[model samples]
Target: MTTPKPRHLETPTETTERERCEQWTDQLFRTSPMVRFMAKHLSLLDCNPLSPFPSASASSSSTSCSSCSSTNPAPAPASAPGQQPKLVIAPCPPSIAGGFSPSLPNEPTSHSSILLCSNRIFSKSHLEDTLSHEMVHWFDHCRFLVDWSNLRHHACSEIRAASLSGDCGFAREFKRRNYAFKLQHQNCVKRRAVLSILANPACNGDKQKAERTVDEVFESCFGDTRPFDEVNNPRLNFKATDEAVY
Candidate 1:
């Protein structure tokens, strides 16, 4: 039997969170029809990445997608032709990461990773929400080879992640009993989008630049949800306060 690629976790909790990540990620991928569609097109490379074969070429030995990312992955290919890319779920420094599609420089691995900050508190529900949010980035990278450095592209993915991940739903607020502010859900998303955007190195801790980028792409990215119909969307009324978003 082919071995599943090894998942890398940066902390001692790696053993535990590995299972948790798989459980959460797989469950979401299975149940969400839109997520399922994205996965089919992804042809997610599951490989024995941690250990390399001696005979393998450098390109095949590592998980590099820069070459493969030139085009959209074919739907349901029986087998992808390159070295399988592992799905690395790891603990990241809160200042620089939460979860994202990163191109690791030193390793030159093409595999994608989602790094959750271990220093912060995380409930199961919170973790699931994070996974869902970052998965959009992964989907965008897989399909569009998105350049995270581009503030506009990053903001667009952030928009879709916030709007589609159910992060701005009233039901979530009701559950948390956090209804003190007007337009609480949308504002919460905007706040989160800003935070995520600020984490990008390009922001250099400039909150204004991050917020401005979010504002510029907010409507377009928030409105565009390919592979998903509107019925599955959250009740987000961003258009009304478009002028007042700042």
Candidate 2:
């Protein structure tokens, strides 16, 4: 008689649990190439959320700005060549309220030449998340080089950025730090869903509609929960990965 292979030692449930944990760990460690690529593009803008603008003479580029005298300078150049051109941040015009709008929230209409916003509020860690979120919008606008005429297109761009943000290790870290602040100030359920949508590559479509579905799923699990402070949070301690869970 032929010898039979020995039976597996582990029970089915144990094996399944082990597999699930492995999958989770894999996700936790996965790195997103897309996020890295986009970050490469972002580095070109050279805007530092932490500091005020530096003088025009200090910048490497040809562009000059009257506002740089008052604002913080950008962080060291992080962008790659052949990427989107950088913009100068300047003071807002009196005509605009709150000194900015989501459409062009960074600078005043008078200084229309700048590509990125230099405003202090946009640079705050939490606000940087918003700015990063908006930059994704601008990135799409640049990529298509046309108006996002359809709802599907808008949804696609947001989804793309969100997915990239989740997988992009640096972007995710930036988001986590920024989000930590918001979590301290207000309910994080909605914010978490927004972050989830940004981090998840699967949620793109019909912007408003997609948001509703995302919101539902988040509420079901988090239920208006506030995240622990970033200093003490366990989830933040994990390394970034392609398969990482948020």
Candidate 3:
């Protein structure tokens, strides 16, 4: 028998949340049907941290579509009718640092573009989180064009995308960030109400209810389960509000 060659092992490198998010986005398009659909209509461009990739390159320029290049020509159009949408992925220009902005009407030529920015300025999770957010924007824009109201529905869509992107952990992080913002705003009553609802055993699916209930009871009895005094102190015009308010 011929000797089998040993498989090469790649070393793992530490990555920030933003880098992780970009990776997750790449993986998502590769696997998710809905994501793949969106990817077709919307180009996901990776922004170069080193040099500025002008919006001009994204719009006015007509480079060959990344998905249609010889090495990876677009797959046979999905069974569904209509022409398959095309997508392009490229490095983001250096000028726009924190995040990529979705195309705006003023920049009509830039429509159907998704900017992927450098991760140095944001947590790796933010890159993925923002991409998911932008994808929802694209879906809305595709269906509604320029209707401003369509963006309102994006919050829920973003949540679903982020969850499905294998970045459900971002949900918890989002809640934490929101909580901190609320605290900073001195919205204690609202914060407590929100926390109570999040702490509810029933919200996390019925299957998890039993375990969550036990955990809640244990925390109530032994842990500092009470909301922060600044947030729920009865002396400061605080009153126990309906949990549903959250």
Largest TM-score belongs to which candidate? 1
The TM-score values for the models, in the order shown, are 0.60, 0.28, 0.32
Candidate-wise lDDT, in order: 0.52, 0.32, 0.33
Question: Which prediction has more favorable lDDT, 1 or 3?
Answer: 1
Worst 10 residues of 2 by lDDT: 224-233
Q: Is candidate 1 or candidate 2 better by TM-score?
A: 1
lDDT of 1 by residue, 115-202 (tens): 5443332554555456556666666665566778888888888878877666666666676577757867567667778988887898
Candidate 3, run of 10 with poorest lDDT: 1-10
Predicted structure 1, TM vs. truth: 0.60
User: After aligning candidate 2 to the native by TM-score, how far in Å is the CA of 52 from where it should be?
Assistant: 20
Candidate 3 positional error at 82, Å? 28
Task: Write the number of the candidate with greater TM-score, choosing between 1 and 3.
Answer: 1
Candidate 2 per-residue lDDT over residues 1-246, each given as its tens digit? 011111255456534433443232222222222222223343333322212233222322222222222122323232233322233333233321011112243542221122222222322232233334444544444434322333344344444433323322344445657445434322333444354444334545334655665544442233211111121121224222222112
CA displacement after TM-score superposition, residue 242 of candidate 2 (Å): 9.3
